[model samples]
Structure formats: C-alpha cells, structure tokens
Target: MTQLIDPFARAISYLRVSVTDRCDFRCTYCMSENMTFLPKADLLSLEELDRLCTTFIRMGVQKLRITGGEPLVRKGILTFFEAMSRHLGTGALKELTLTTNGSQLTKFAEPLAALGIKRINVSLDTLDPAKFAQITRWGRLPQVLDGIAAAKAAGLRVKINAVALKGFNEDELFSLTDWCAANDHDLTFIEVMPMGDDMGSATRLDQYWPLKDLRARLAERFALTDLTEQTGGPARYVRLAETGQKIGFITPLTHNFCESCNRVRLTCTGELYMCLGQEDMADLRAPLRANPEDAGLEQAIRAAIARKPKGHDFDYSRQKVAGKIGGQMTRHMSHTGG
Candidate 1:
C-alpha cells in the first residue's frame, strides 16, 4: 500500500469532511446572521461522500470527522452517519468523530453513540445565559445545556470547546475551568480567529487571548503538566498537575500548529482545502462530477496533496502587508465547515 506523505513529511491521516456549509447558529466570530448559504444541489451526495471517504481511507486517513454548517440540521444525516459508520468500522480508519455546536444534539446524541461515535466536541463559549444569547444572536442556553446533558447521558465522551473571546468570557477562565472539572468534561479553550469582518477592527485583535498566557494563569492556580494522550485533532493537551483534569488549547493564531498539521478540509461543495487559513485548494466537484471513479478521484486527490501549502499564513499579531492588515482567513469559518 502506498502512503500519503506531503512534501513537508507530514503523513496525512485526518480528514474534516463538511457535509454542509450551513449552520443554524450565527456566532459572532464565525459569520454574519444574514449570511447566504449554498443551495442543496451544490452539496455532495451521500454516494459521493462515501467514495471520497473510501479514497481517503485508502490513502491512510485513519481519523474522519464529520462537520457541517450544522450536520444534524441536514435531513437524513443520521442515516448517512449509520452507513458511514458501518463502512468505516470495516475499513482501515481508526475512529470517527464529530464537532458540533450542540444546538441539535438532544434527539441525536444517544443515536450517535449507538452508531459508534463515542467522541464528541461541543462548542460552548460561555456559561452566562445573557452572554451566550449575545454571542450566538438567538441561541438558547437551555437547549444547548440539554444537548450537553443528552450527549453525556448517551455514554459519549464530551469535550467542551470554548472560544476565549475578548471582552466576552476572558474573565470566566478560572470559573470555566472549575465548571468543566466539576462536570467531568474536558475543557479546550480556543483562541478567537478573525472570520467575519474581523469582528470589528477595534475588538478583533483584543479578543485573542493566547493559550501560552492561559497556561501561565493555570499554573498559578493548579499544577499544570503536559498530557500524553493521543488526540484526533491538533490540540495541545494538558493535565492539571494536582487533580489530573484534562485541558486543551487550540491556539491557531498565537501558537500556530501548522508544522504538525496532518489534516485537510473538504467543503460540502467538493472543494478540497489544503489548509483552513489559506485559499490553497482544488475543485473536487469538477473531477467527481466528470468521473466519480477510483482512477479519476484518486488522481485529483493526489494532485491536490502534492500542491498542498507547506504552512498557513496565520499571524496572531496582525501584520501590515502593502498597507492592508492581514492574518484573517479569506474564507468564512462557516463556509469552511468549522
């Protein structure tokens, strides 16, 4: 079997497949509430998704994560999950997981766990109801809490993914850590990345509280130690040196993890992105539509990998390039299926 190693010697094993580029919630950092989404016809069907997943597995992608604008909102998504879980269970893939906003997990959590999805990441930035509503625009804090409960009741390993938005939840850092510890859920604090109009020029850069400083703060409260757990994604895991509570920091802006980046993103419209921050990509829809065969599909995927960028262009400090402020992604996070 031939291996898939990029020019940087990073063996690609993880694939983040966005089933749709539409979400119900409009997070301030992700996109605008009045965002336009792709039409249904532009999305990749389950059949196409199957072929793509198989091709990726053949190329040594052992970890496959299903993403979406919000995957659960899509009709017949469970049926698709069932089919894909069965197929991947028999394939070379090591595990299948998902990342969601936990908005629609109430009815799907137990079913998801039954279908072999044990690990789940739920995006919940703050514990404050008023602030949650403000950040999500119209998101209900109770429904999301219920979703988290459902996920835990279904025997799923739930990791709370919180974005450290400036002026939003930075003050709750210590409290959030305690809350996660008390609830028996692992906590991963992610830095806020620029997506929608840079979330206002006055507040954009200020919102990014680096994980390096977060670690220093945690050290003062609890003994912090590096974790040796194998994570499916690029989160730097740490354990509380005192009680061994698990914590993670995904600092894409401050501490870029591009060198150890072994993953690629595929949008619902069949655009394969080599990196999330950059615009380096190939149109898989063209090849898949023209000839959805093994020969054609594999050739296109291999070509994209060959041309994958060595690293992303993410600068936390926001640099000036020819009088233009840079570092934010050219594409929206919602469209990228994050």
Candidate 2:
C-alpha cells in the first residue's frame, strides 16, 4: 500500500470550483458596474472542469462545491451538473453542493435536485424587497425569494448566505434571524471580505459588524449555543429564545477561523488558489489542456496541494506590514467562489 502525503499541514478534503468569472449582478463588495472579466476564451472547457473534478476525487476529495460568478449563468449548466453527478457516483464525493445568487434557482431547482445536488446556499442580504434590490442592483428581490421557496420545496437543504455589511444591512441582522426561524431556514452571517478591485478606502476591519454586537443582540433574544465539535467547522450555532430558531455566524475577519480551514478553491481560469486571501496559485489548466496522462494530471494536483498556505491572517497587527495598506488585492470573492 502507498502512504498518502498531506503537504499543507491542513487536511484539504473539500474543493470549491468557480465555474465562471462572470455574474449577472454586480455586488458592491464583489465587482463594480464597469468591471470587465476575463474573456470567454480564458475560461476552462467543461471537459477540463470534469477532468479536474475526477482528479480531485481520486486524490481523496470528499466534498465538491460548484460556485460561480453565479454558477447557473453558465450555458448548459444542467449538463455540467450531470457530468459532475456521474463522476461523483463513484462514491468518492460524499456531497455535491452549490452556492448561487438564487436568481435562476426557480427554473433549475427541480432538475438540480434530481441530479443529486445535496444542498444550496443562497446569497441574500436583506429580506425587504426594496432593500434587496438596492444591494443586488439588477436582482429582483421577489424572484430571488421565490427561488428560495422553490429550492426548499424541492427538498434541497437550503441556507442563506448574508454578509453583515455595516451601515447597509447590519441593522436587519436580528430581524433576518427571526425571519429564517419563522421560515424554518438556516442562516449564516458572514463578515465582509476585502478582495475586490474597488475596495477603495472604505474596506477596513473596523467597518465589520462586530461579533460582540451580533452576539449581544442574539443573546438577548435567543439562547446562543455552540455546536459540538463533531458537527464540523466552527459557525457557532444558537437557538432563538422564543421559537427555538437556529442561526449561525461566520466571523472570518474579526475572529479568524484559518486554523480549522479545510477547503481549497479552483478558479474558472484554471488556477488553484490555496487560500482566498493569499496571492499564490498553481495552474493546473496548462497540464490538463495538454491532455496529460492520469499520472501526469495527478502529479500536477499534488504540486498544487504542496503550495497551500498554512492559514490566512487578516489581523492587520499580525499582518507582515504595520499601519500601511499594501498594493491592490488580486481576486474577488466571486472568482474565488467564496
């Protein structure tokens, strides 16, 4: 028997692939209205995506997540899901999931559920229709809400991915929590990430919705409780006081969870990014485009694994430079499939 090697101290068992760098909505923290993405010719072919998924499965990947500039925006998306489902049928992947803006879920939910899409995480920041429209710009709040309802009806485990943006929607956090409880839905409140080309001068740790404030508000209304260690990664679960509602918090900026990070990202441009905040990447697209043998492909993946960073340190005090902001950041959350 051959002994398996774990190069990055952190055990990477999950892969998040960004199928495209293009999205329908221009999120404030993701892209500007004038932002231009890589040309269509730069994206990986569906065949290339399939080969990468197969190789990762062979290398002990257990969970695969399909993300996008809105993954559903890609043409022939259902066919792509079918291909991934077929490859995952080998029992190598324990779960196949997706993260979407929910704009297209109403039309694609049933077929996706049938294709073994285990769960879905929808990005919805506000519950108010008008406010939601303002945040997503081109998104129709009513349509997204309908899509969420449809996904739940299709028996897909549904979760909301809301970013806690200060001055924008942080005031609605508790209200959103209550709404999720009433709707029997799970909610994850994520901290805003500063990775876009236009973070400008407004992106700072001080602007984040402090966990202390969030926790205080929740504690007043709910009995916030921590989940057992075996339940998986740290989200810090809690139950609403009046209705036993469940809510989660992902405080990556203020309270870094890098030590327990268990995933890697594959970009649509064929680059393997070990950390969302890191600049290092390994290009597997070149080797795979060359139609290399299985061994050659495996070697390329292993090399990518070897480059994974130990962890991301967002704490400016702990960051290498002090008091000074560095040059422009490289990738956006959409490209990294956050």
Candidate 3:
C-alpha cells in the first residue's frame, strides 16, 4: 500500500472530487446570477472519474467526498455513487460521502443511504424561506426542507453547513441552531472565503463575517465546551451544553487550519487543486486519457502531491473597505466544487 505524503509531511488521505461545475442555485456568494459553466465535453466521464478515484484508493486514500455546484443535479449521478459503494464494502475506503444543498435529497436520499453513505453535509444558510431564496437566488425553501426530512427518514446523519454572512444570516444564527437541535442534526458555521470572481470582490468583502464574532455571539446563548475532535476536515468542534449538539467552526480567516491539512480537491474537468486558496493545479486528464494503464496518471498525482503548499493565503484584514479585494482567488467557489 502506497501513501501520499506532501513535502510538509501531511499524509494526503482525503479527496474531494467535483462531479460537475453546474449548479441549480446561483448563490449570491458562490457565483454570479448569470454564470458561464464548463462544457460537458470538458468534464471527465463517469467511468474516468471512477478509475481516477479507484487509483487514489489503491494508493491509500481513505475518505472520498463527492461535491459539485450541487452534486445531485448531475444526471445519472446515482450510478457513480453505486459504483463507489464497492470500495466501502471492501473496507479499502473508510468513508464515502457528499456535500449537497439538500434540494434533491428527497429523490436520492434512500438510494444514497442504501449505497453506504452513512452521513452527508447539506449546505443550508437560512431557515427563513424568503432569506433562503435571497441567499441561494434560485432555491425553494419548502423543497429543501422536505428533502432534509427525506434524508433523515432514510437514516442518513445530516450535518448542516451555514456560511456566516455579515448582515445576511446573522439574525438567523439562533434560529438555525435551534432548528438543527430540534431536528437532531449537527450544524457547522463557515466563514466566507475570498474565492472566485463570479461574486464580485466587493460582495466577498461585504459577505465576510468572521467566525470569531459569530462564536462570541453563540457563546452568549449557549455554553460551548471546546472539543479536540478531528473529523478529517478543517473544522474545530465545540459542544453546546443546552442542546448537547456539536457545532463546528471552519474559520479559514480568523483561525488557520492549514498545518494539519490532509486533503486535496479534484475538479470535474480532472484538474487537481492541492490547496483551495492557491491557484496552482495539476492537469490529470491528459494522462488519464492518454494512457489506459494509469502509470502516467499515478506519476502525475505523486508529483502534484510533492508540490502541495503548507498553507493557503486567505486573508480579509488587508482591506477595511469594500472596494478592494484582498487575498482572493480568481476562480469561483462552484468552479472548485465548494
């Protein structure tokens, strides 16, 4: 068994693969209302994706997370999930999960749970129907709520990921928390990162709400006990005394979780991004398409891992005003399959 160890000595055991860049909702912070998506021909075929993922698993990748603009929106995505379930059965892959918007969970929840996905992270910023529409642009609140119900009924552990927007979702913090607690779902709050140009730099700046502030506010209501639990992701966990629910904070800006970073992202087009905040990427599609034996593909991946950076440069303190963008990536969050 081969293991991928970066120059920084962090073993790369987690892989986030984007199945599609196309999303149904044009979230205000994720992308522009009118977005230009990658052509279908440019994306790696399902068979190619399965091969690439299997190659990584062979090299000791333990956890695989399927992401997209919205993974369920992709046509025939269940077949891919069904195929990956075999790795789980063999115990070679420790876990196979996905991050979704919860809109399509109503239709796919049962099948996903049957395919061996024990848990999933659903992106839900607001419980208010109007605010939900305002944030997600093209989303329907009732539809997502129903989908969540279906997912819960299917026995999938649901984790709600809410982006802490400055003025947008601030009022709903307690509401979101209470809802998650009542529903027996875990909740995680994420600070907005300066990623992509689809949402203007000014909007990113305006949307940037430090998790530090959000945590302080949360502390006012609930007694939070810090817990040193690592979920193989970049989130620091704390348990609330009142609800006994675990809340996670992904503070890329306020607190850097880079020193222990052990994951890499692969776009739908087969581009491997070693770091989310860094633009450097390795193109694995050429090798995968050129050689059927996967020798070239394996070499390309090892080389890419060797060049992984120690940390990402995502800082929001440089600019006090909204006009200037600071330390922001040029690619959209959806492009990298947030």
Candidate 4:
C-alpha cells in the first residue's frame, strides 16, 4: 500500500470529507444567517465521493470522518455511510464516524450504528435553551437534546464538542461538565477559530476564548488528570478525577497542535484543503470527473498531500499589534467541513 507522507514526515492516516455544504442551522460563528450555499450541480455525487474516499483509503487512510454544514442533513447520506462501511468489514478502514450538530441523529443514529460507526462528535455550545437558540439561529435545543438521547439509546458513543466562546459560554463550564458526566458522555472544549469573511471573522475574534483560560477555570472546580490518549484528531485529553469522565481541549489558537497532524479535509466540491488556516487548496473534482479509473485520482491526491504545510497559520496574538487578526482563512469553517 502507498502511504501519504508530507514534507514534515507526518503520515496522513485520517480524512474528513464533506458530503454537502448545506446545513439546517446558520451558526453565528460558522456562517451568516442568510448564507449563500453552493449549487447542487457543483457538488460531487455520492458515488463520486465514495470513489474519492476509496482512493484515499487505498493510499493508507484508516480513519474516515464524514462532515458537513451538517452531514446528516444531506439527502440520501445514509447510502454513503452504508457504502463506506464495507471498508470497515474488510478491515481496510479502522473507523467510520461523523461530526454533526445533533439535529438529525434521531433519524440517522440506528442506521449509522449498523454501518459500524461506533462514535461521533456533536457540536453543542450551550445547554441553556435560550442560549442554544441564540447561538444556532435555526436550531431548537429540545430537538437536539432528543436527537442526542436517541443516539445514546442506539448505542453510539457521543462526544460533545463545545466552542469556548469568551462571553457566550463562560458560565456553562461547570454546568456543561456536570451534564456530560451525568449523561456518560465525553466532552471537548475548542477555541474559536478565525475563519470566514468580515462579519464572521469579527464575531469569531470577539468570541475567542483561549482554551488555556477555560482549562484553568475547569482546574479550579475539578481535579483534572492529564491523559496521553490520542484519537487521530487534534483534541488532547484529560480525565476528571471526581466524575471519571474524559475531557478534551482543542487549543488551535493558544497552542498549535499541528506537529502531529495526520489528516486532510475534503470539501463537498472535491477540493482538498491541506491546511485549514491557509487558503491554499487543490481541486480534485476536475481530475476525478475526467476519468473513472483511480490512477489520475491517486496522483492528484498525492500531489496535494505533497504540498501540505508544516502547520496552519492560525494566530490570534497579531490582534495586539495593529488590531488585526492574522492567518485567517477566507473560507467559512463550514465550507472546510468543520
């Protein structure tokens, strides 16, 4: 098997693919309320996505994560999941998982679990109904809670991914931690990243709450034991001694976790983003659509992987210099399968 190794000698073993760019909710920090979505015609069909994914798997990708604006919102997405499960059965894929907003899990949990998806990440910022509604403009807290319940009932291990917004969720640190412990779910706190356009960037900068601060706050309330576990993602883990529940911190801004990066993101339109904080990308759709065989597609993927940067340029310290956010990508996080 051919292995994908970048200039930094990091093996690319994980791939996050976005099946669709359309999402049901217009998250404030992610995209605008009246966001412009890509046309369906521009998106690669399910079969095309499958082929692209298979190519990556053949090139030594073991972990496959399906992402989207909300991956479950895409029509006929289960079929894609079903198709990817064959790799798990054959032992070619180590895991098949997804990151969702937890809105559609009630409908997809069973099907996904049957397809060999053992765990998933849910993007939930707050437990307060009013605050949840305010953060996700179109989201209903009750519905998402119901969906999360359904996922748990369906035997899927759910991990809650909360963005550490400065003023938005500061008060919920203990509340959220206690809730996750009570529900028997792992929780991860992420720093708000500087991506997207002016409006979104402005909001992200204002919302930026460094994970260092959040961790310090958590340490005050709970005894956190540092963990050395890695799950093929950026989040570093810690275990709460009191509740015995695991907590993860993804500090992209405060700390750069790019040295051991082993993944690449594929957009719905078949664009491969080597680094999320940089604007550089490679278009694989043209080569993919031009031929049915895997030779050209494999070559294109390798070429893109070869150009992968050592680390993303996501820096918030530049704001101290001239009141400017540095290393901000022009595309929205949703567009890059966040």
Measured on C-alpha atoms, candidate 2 has an lDDT of 0.77
On residues 1-338, what C-alpha lDDT tens digit does candidate 4 reach at each position?
A: 66999999999999999988889998887887899999999999999999999999999999999999999988999999999999999999999999999999889999899889999999999999999999999999999999999999999999999988888999999999999999999999988887767533445567788888889999998898999989889999999999999999998887889999999999999999998878889999999999888799889999999999999888776643234456766688899898
lDDT of 1: 0.83
**Could you estimate the TM-score for every candidate?**
0.95, 0.92, 0.97, 0.97
Off by over 4 Å in 1: 319-323
Candidate 3 lDDT score at position 9: 92
The 10-residue segment with the lowest total lDDT in model 4: 317-326
By lDDT, rank the candidates, best first. Answer: 3, 4, 1, 2
- Model 4 stretches with alpha carbons more than 4 Å out: 199-203, 320-325
What local distance difference test score does each model get? 0.83, 0.77, 0.92, 0.90
Q: What is the overall TM-score of model 2 with all chains considered together?
A: 0.92
Which candidate gets the maximum lDDT versus the true structure? 3
Cα TM-score of candidate 1 = 0.95
lDDT of 1 by residue, 188-300 (tens): 98887766555436666667777788778888889888877767576889889776689998988776688888999998888999888787889888888787467787888
Candidates 3 and 4, the one with greater lDDT: 3
- Model 4 residue 157 CA deviation (Å) reads 0.2
